[model samples]
Target: MGSSGRRQSRRAVVVATVTPLASILGSGLLIIVPVLERTLGALAVFGAVAICAVAWLIGTVIRHNVLVVEPLKGAGSLDRATLLLGRIADATIVVAYIISVALYLRIMAQYLVRFFASSAPDFLEPLIACVAVALIVALGILRGFRGLERLDRVSVVAVLLLTFVLGAVLLFHDGSSLVGGDLTMPPVPRMNPLEILLVLGGIVITVQGFETVRYLGDQYDAVARVRASRVAQIISAFIYIGFVAVATPVMGLGTPAGADSTLLDITTRIAPWLALPLVLSAVLSQFSAAIADTAAADGNLRGLSRWFHGPRPYLISGAAAIAIAATVPTFTIVAVASRAFAAYYAIEAVIAMRTSNGFARKSFYAVLALLLVAIALFALPAS
Candidate 1:
């Protein structure tokens, strides 16, 4: 290929990568710091690393399926068990996407309301979220996300730039404090190993967007999708780990309130000037993610049932998300979404095991599946 062709190919891959990358960082970027600090305290970076590692492994399973199971199904070579499992996986992903739509809108609502009125009533957030879901449904029904999808590139780039800037500022602050002989670690939270494990499992939703690649087969070939998924995971893992590491030390400045806007509070203390931009990025990321997941859920529902044609899936998903946003606490919504996605990943692992040939590969998938099963069964909301 010529230089122009190579550049175009690379650009296409980057565009494909933005979808999953934006979804991964959307709500997670705003929430992960607060959750990790509250759950693991001074050891928060390690917890961040652990979560990113598990997400990468799950991404591996998804990429494997893109390469293996997709072809098997395409050729009508999948066995009955694998085919059944694939159907189950599709249903599970739809549930996960619904919960995530609620999650993204809920978090976005919190940021929007709190940014305007710090003491906004609790009910206001859910109301705004419901309104946003309704808007998405209307748009989906009138016109699909083709135009709005363009926002993914803009939002993801803005988010990545803002995140790296925040990370850099925090790192500089920490370094100056250390050089001034005033750096102090945050107070460590005392939780039993089981509690720690449960909290870890619960936050899996923070890294849940890599699977978005699996549903992008219509837009990109399997090779491009797999490449995009892997690249997105690797890039997000580094960003998550680095942000957690730099921000954890300053967490000692104040106790995290365990709310969706906790990161905003932390940023206010360190870099008040950056707070507005961060909130803007939060809003963009969350809304774009909600759009992506709502569209994905609608598509999956259509695929699963003949009755779900046209805007019916969008209406159903929007209604469910509104109900969830109204009734469920934000952290509980996060855990529930995490478990639903974990269940989907577990089933994908089983499909990989059934279709792939090597004993080592099968054993690897079995272990990952078991871990995901445990996550699905035991993940709990952070208290």
Candidate 2:
């Protein structure tokens, strides 16, 4: 392709990539905001923000400068730790999906329990997420990046319009009340700095979509993909922060009703018509993000085998995706999958960090190892 043509193509790639990623990240923050406000406290949530910022900066910088990121890394096993750079991107996607799915299921369950205490189940949400993961991996193995990108773009438009219209309604109707935050919050709730780090860890997972670019490394121009990935990451992070800022004050941290979507509920109060559309769009967006993340895991595995000297690790690339799907099986299953997806994200982040930094960074992996244990515990099937 000519330079002008390539530039246009690159621009198209950026549009296609950035929109869906930003949408996914925005949705993710909807979940994280409440968790920070309630579970970790606002002060503690900052730690999560700091950790995520540093980890992502390191990951992105390495991908852009130090590595020659190739999408199809397993092409010849050893020549491609060069390919491992792709992990930075994959780490971002997986982490966000897991965290978002967990929040989605958790929020839905709380609502369900209020209406039908006997019928509601906690574990079901993640199981459904896991099933979606399977569909995602299966489709990813068969389809190309173009198809996924198209899905993301379509999802982004539907989601943004739906969220904006509905969220506005909820905010205007509900947030204007002076007695609002007090309605759902405890008398003496407080925020700490440490728990904020955990919240930051959760939110960081939401903004990650850089890996998508690496998959198209060969199809699109390299410089464009790299630049696009960086831009996409920045845009996604901003959206996440913006959504949380807009959402937290309106929803109040103590209430689960406003948590999954503090913004949406506010809109529901003002313009209830927006509720059904918002939920539908929210679910669809989550599903699309899950598929995209699973595909990324496949791509990450393909990249990792290059250095492991493990005969190109084809099956391993698809293993987590497949196993996750098999366990959850369908949309009916949510809890297991959501938890697994979260676990996957945490693992991917630590691994990506470990791989990029020298062995001197080995100690970080140990810390990551501990973080994984904590994630597993927090996201356990029963919990």
Candidate 3:
């Protein structure tokens, strides 16, 4: 490739790699923020960002160490414990994806009912999103990461643009609110250490997409993958911080019609003209994210079993996702998913430390400590 060609290729790789990560992270914020609010109030934004930074470090190390060129296998130590733990970690990730899709379906359904078609039944959004996801997976419409990434490039850009517009309007309307705001770290209350710990543990799920870097083993060199993953994490952090900073303060200004309607709530409060567009963007972004996640879950399923390594695995998995989405409430599944993911992170920390050496191993040890603290918090009673 020529210099121009090289640059274009690089941009595509970055976009392809980063956009799905961005989509997944953007969709996750709605669920993550509320969990944070229970413990840190507005400071949850900063806490979440801090966790992202550490997650980025830990994820990059794992990605570097666990390169998987083949879709069905990973490169790592061959001990039975390592292999068993690796399967558990991968299975845990698959479970997270499934639960997230169910939550997305419920949220999407609510958005459609409230904004787009008041007469539409509450079940419409999940039905449509589930069918779309099923068709895409079953038909193999998305060829691989590259295809999904192409779709995500558009989805992520639309999501970020609308989010920027919303944040800008919110900030302009309430610049004073933020100015007088003391964003200093608040002391954790002494009375409910257990309750506080669970919230802290849940915050770990906010940085869920960083591990996605491992899938790039086939398409990019190690250096390229590292740079791309780091860039994606930084972008996601700013996006999360920007939204939380603006949205959390403005939340009290207007009541969202429903729990899942934060984006619509803020946009309607500060810039009514932007609400529809924001809603549209959010729906599309989330739908795209659902597709990406469903695809990923199917891929992981195939990786885990030879019977699943066929044309119908996506169909089977996608149907299961739809079934789960159709039956469950949003937050209930979200809470379950968050706890499951926290467990995954805890296991992942052990795996990374066990398989690593030198500085990487030390870093995993530090992260392992953090994960343990977070997990212990979850074991405590609600404050």
Compared with the true structure, model 3 gives a TM-score of 0.78
Q: Write the per-residue lDDT of candidate 3 for residues 178-225, one digit (tens) a residue.
A: 576842323333435556655555545556666666665666665566
User: Any residue pairs clashing in model 1, and if so which?
Assistant: none
**Per-residue lDDT of 380 in model 2:** 22
Residue 331, model 3: Cα distance from true site in angstroms? 1.8
Any idea what lDDT model 1 has?
0.88
Order the candidate numbers by TM-score, best to worst: 1, 3, 2
By TM-score, who's the top model here?
1
lDDT tens string, model 2, 56-78? 55345335332431322334532
| Of candidates 2 and 1, the better by TM-score | 1
Report the C-alpha lDDT of model 1 over 41-119, residue by residue, as the tens digit: 8899999989998998888899999998888899999889899999999999999999999999989888887778988
Instruction: Give Cα-based local distance difference scores for all models.
Output: 0.88, 0.47, 0.62
Query: Distance from true position, residue 181, model 1, in Å?
Result: 0.8
Lowest summed lDDT across 10 adjacent residues in model 3 is found at 252-261
- The candidate scoring highest on lDDT is 1
Q: How many residue pairs clash in each candidate?
A: 0, 34, 2
